[model samples]
Every structure is written in structure tokens, then in C-alpha cells.
Target: MSGDHFHVHGPHDHAVEHAGHGGDDFASQIAVMTAILATVGALFSYQGGATQNDAMLHKNQAAILKTEAANQWAYYQSKGNKQNMAELGAVLTSDEHRNKFEDDVARYKAEKEEIKKKAEALEEKVKAEDELSEASMHVHHRWAQAMTAIQIAISLAAITLLTRKKWLKYGAWGTAAFGAALAALAIAHI
Candidate 1:
């Protein structure tokens, strides 16, 4: 290992060879990665908004169903003295309450028909909220799928950009952050 024109051997570092375009490619990669991450972030925000809207809708719907159920029970309880209890089936399943039950059923059916009409008119009624919330959850899930595609693409591109083994592993960690955020939001709804 003489100092006079000595030769030393190690890994043939390609760093210098690719170093010429490294900065350019790195910038390009960073720009693309930024765009993808921004898109994912925007989608996450959108999903959050959707979830809020859906939760409000569900709360409203639960209230309406609760009210309707209470009203229905009250109607049965309001069987007054003006109409003989025997003629108006006090007990729904009593065999002796046949004719009265039939009469009460007809009246109840009429009320139901009226309620159906009202419901149809008020499309925004809270009655159908649970169904709407269930639907929102599905949409959120699909949105997450779309977001996943972006995450995957970003990760692959990041891997390609990262030559260092340490950075390569770290890239995966960064990519997973988006998925973890989306999962957290989704589980909140559940």
C-alpha cells in the first residue's frame, strides 16, 4: 500500500456516474410524489366531510324513527272510553278481539298509508338515515380503494428514486401513513 500511485479496490460506486442526473430525477420524483400525496390528502379531506355529513344524517334519522315508534305505541295506548274496548281490539292477538282487531287494523292501515305519503313527500326525512349511513360507509370504502392505488404508485416511484437501502425502507413507512389515516377515518364510522 505504497503512497506512490497506490491502488485501492472497493465497491465500484455508480453514485458518480448517476450523480449527473440524480438531482434532476430527484426533483422530478419529488414533484410527482408531492402531487400524489396532495391528491391523497385532498381525498382524505373529502372523505372526512362525507363522514360528517353522514353522521348528521344518521342522527336525524334515528331521531325520526324514535319519534315514529313512540307515536305508533301511543296510538295503541290512546284507545279511549268513547269506543268500547271490546269493539276496538285492545289486545292485538286475542282471539276474541277478531272484529275489533279487523277494524283497528283498517284504521291503522289508513294511518300508515298517510304516513307513507308524508314520507314520500319529505324525501329528506330522517327515517331513512341508517340506510343512508350504510351507503356512505360503502362510498368511503371505495374512496379508500382509489386512494390505495395512488399510494401504491407513489410507493413504487419512491422506491425507484431511492437508491439507499435505508431510504428505501423509510419510503414504505411514508406511504403507509396515508393508508393508516384512511383506515382511522373509516373505523370511526364503523
Candidate 2:
């Protein structure tokens, strides 16, 4: 009976010590994970801000292009009006005035063609800029998603630390992996 009691107590004490060690190990792991999470979170946040800034820059460029295109169209309209006046003058005037008005009409038509080409090119540029803005916005969205996951993972880590649950730590790691994946996708967009 004495031998059996010692044996039981020995195993019990060993189990307790092992349990204590497990907790300590998990605590250290959580500390390391928390640090990693903080670093990744900061990086994701910076990326999100950069992508947002890029989107805004593209949008501003598109707006400027659109404004310039509008100015060019207005100039084209003025040229059209001048061409019409010249055509009317040609019909109502004498031969000397008619020749001059015809020449003026031709010049105005050529200038209108040039202006049309420029305006169309500007429209294309605006479209390209808008597309860039959309792409940047998409990257920003990915970064936002990553940030969300990272934040959740960080919160879970805190919970794991408080509760001393190894399963919760595993769950936190899973969430952190998801966040990292999202960040990778966002970076790959470049």
C-alpha cells in the first residue's frame, strides 16, 4: 500500500510539472506569435494606405485629363462655328470674298480634325487613368481584408494568452495564415 501510494503521487507530481511546462511553452509561443502579428499588421496597414493614395492619384489624373478633353471639345465647337460662318460668307459674297471664305473654311476644317484627334486621345488617356484608379482601389481592398484578418488574429492571440488554451492558439495561427495569404495576394497585384 505504501509503495502504491508513492507511485501514484510520483506520477501525479510529474503530470503537474508537465502541465506547468506546457503552459510556459505555450506562453512563450504566444509572445513570439504576438510580435510577428504586430509586425505583419503594421506592414499591411502601410500597404493599405499606399494603395489608397495611389488610387487617389490616379483619380486626380483622370479628372485632369477629362477637364483638358472638355476644353479641347469646346475649342472644336468654336472651330465648327467658324467653319459654318465661313461657308455662309462664301455663298452670300462676291467672287473676291468667296475665295477668301472658301480658304478660311478649309483651314477651319483641317484645324477641327486636329482638335478632334487630340480630344479623342485625351479621352483615351482619361479612360486609362480611370482603369489604373480602379486597379489601385482593388489592391486597397485586398489590403483592407488582410488587415481585418490580422486584427482578428491579434485579438485571438490575446484571448489565447488569457485563457491558456492551446486550441485557441492554433486557431490564432490559422487566422494569421489567412491574413498573410491576403497580403501576398495584394502584393502580387503589382
Candidate 3:
């Protein structure tokens, strides 16, 4: 209470004020721990989001490659159909025209082989992209788990601050450690 000024002290503010006076070291320690956990949680959340985005990008690439592979397969099928038609023509045509039809059949067969090879290559690329997407998603999940643990630790810290419970403080520390472990796992991509 000061001239022309008013102040209100909430429970947290009172606790912090006491902490400044060396009255409640536990409160101050919890406050510091909460701040650190919040910072680490934010970083974990960012990493989770980044990994999710990477997964989506890789998935999209896989889809595009799959479509290209499908198109190649379709082209190969069309060539096969053309080859069948040429073979039919060679069997029904006169000797003079038979050789020309046979040549056309051989050309179609070669072209189909090339198209098949291209389609198989595209399929392989799709598989690779899909695997990349899955790996990114796994990392993202690990980050999310780490973030969840950190959030729980933060909540526990707040509760401990309010109740001055030693058990809750220990729980918060344990949860924070678990979160750090998960974050390490994410970093290692394991």
C-alpha cells in the first residue's frame, strides 16, 4: 500500500516474496525448476512439430512417386497390349507384311521392357520415401512423449509450489528426468 498506488498479493506472489527473504527456499527452487522445465518443454514441442512437418513432406513425396509409378505401369500395360495386337497382325497378314508386323511386335516388347524398368525404379523410390516418412513420424512421436512428460513435470511443480509437498517435488524431478531421457532418445533417433 502506497500513495496513489494499490497492490495485490496472490498466493504465488506471497510465496515468492517470502522466498526473497529466505523464508521459503522450496518455493524459489520450485519456481526456478518450473521455468527451466517450461523452456525445455517449449523446445521439445518445437522439435515435435518440425518432425511432424518432415513426415508430411516425406509422405507427400512418396505419394507423388507412387502416382508416377502407377503411370509408368499403365504405360507398360498399354505397350503390352500394342505388342499383342502386333503379334496378332503378324499371324494374320501376308508373308510380305508379316515381317513388318513382327518388327513392330519386337519394338513394342523392347519399349515395354524399358517402361517396366522405369516403373520398378519409381516403385523403389516410393518405398524409400515411405520409409523416410515413417522414421520422421517415429521421431515426432518421441518428441511428443518427451513434451508430455515435461508438461506433467511442470504441473507437478506448480502443485508442489501451492501445497509445499516434498513428495510432489520429488515426482516433478523424476518426471523431468524422464522427459530428458525421452528427448535424448529422440535426438538419437532410437
Candidate 4:
């Protein structure tokens, strides 16, 4: 026989070797499934981060608007104080000064009205932004749930490989399906 000649194994040995290779194939399939699950989990993580960032940005904007509204209210208060001081000065002075202070008071009142309107409008804007932030946070929560499911599925897949349990692989599939459903809901913003 040539050095490169093939040796044919007995039927029983062949069957045993085939069974061993079958186990290896099963392990490889589980590894592939775990990798795919990890990829999906990574995508969900990105979406979760993005939604969280959006919520934070909207909250920040609302805070800024509230701060500006507070500043406007403060300005309105200052105007009110100045008007009162002017009125008091007029009482302590002459008729001409009284007329001038009356004009000043009217101007301050008008300006205060304008400021109040602006502050109220800003409050409305803040409310709207807060609603947006809440919505984004809701989406983020969904994505977070999806991430958790995906992670669980991946862990199950690893356990399946370790224990050579077919049932565990099925459980991994079930969890992966659940994760996909959550991810879909998140994408729909529901």
C-alpha cells in the first residue's frame, strides 16, 4: 500500500466518529446562534443609548426654559418694586413729579404684562418638552427590556453549549423571540 493510501474504518468506529462530529456540529451551531444574539443585543444597546440621550437633551431644554421663565418672573417683580418706589417718590414731591411717576407706573405695568405673557408662553413650551422627554424615556425603557431579554438568550445559548441540552437551545430561541418583540415595540415608539 502507498503511504497516502486511505484506511477504511469498521462500521462501528465510523458510527462513533460520526456521532462525535455531530456533537461538534451542534456546539458550532449554538456558538453561531450566540454570536447572532450578541449582535442583536449590541444594536438594541445603541438604540437604548440614543433614546436615553434624547430624553436627557429634552429635559435639559425644558430646564433651560424654566430657568428663563423664572428670570422673566424675577424681572416682572423688579418692575413692580420700581413702580411702587416711583409712586412713593411722587407722593413726596410735586404735581409734575407725580405725573411723571404715574407715567412710569403705567409703563412698568405694561412691561410686566408683556413679561408675564412671555413667561407663560415659555411655561407652555417647557410642558411640551417635558412630554417629549417622557416619551423618549418610555422608548428607552422598552429598549432596555429588549436588551435584557437578548442578554438572557445569549446566556442560555452558552449554557446549552456547556450542557449539550437541546431544551436550553429552545429556551434561548424563546427568549430571543421575546427580545425581538420588545425591539419591534421600541422601534414603533410604543
TM-score of 4: 0.84
Candidate 1: C-alpha lDDT: 0.60
- Model 3 ranges off by over 4 Å: 1-20
Q: Can you write out model 3's per-residue Cα lDDT over 1-190, one digit (the tens) per residue?
A: 6688988889998887776565657887999999999999999999999999999999999999999999999999999999999999999999999999999999999999999999999999999999999999999999999999999999999999999999999999999999999999999999
TM-score of each: 0.45, 0.86, 0.89, 0.84
User: Can you list the residue pairs that collide in candidate 2?
Assistant: none
The better candidate by TM-score, 3 or 4, is 3
Q: How many backbone clashes are present in model 4?
A: 0
Residue pairs in clash, model 3 = none
lDDT of each: 0.60, 0.94, 0.95, 0.94
Off by over 4 Å in 4: 1-23, 90-92
Is 1 or 4 the stronger prediction by lDDT?
4
- By how many angstroms RMSD does model 1 differ from the true structure? 10.8
Ranking by TM-score: 3, 2, 4, 1
Clashing pairs in 4: none
Q: Lowest summed-lDDT stretch of 10 residues in model 4?
A: 17-26
Shift of residue 134 alpha carbon in model 4, Å: 1.7
Candidate 2 Cα deviation (angstroms), residue 111: 0.2
Q: Which candidate is the best by lDDT?
A: 3
lDDT string for model 2 (100-163, tens) is 9999999999999999999999999999999999999999999999999999999999999999
How close to the true structure is residue 151 of candidate 1, measured as C-alpha lDDT?
A: 68
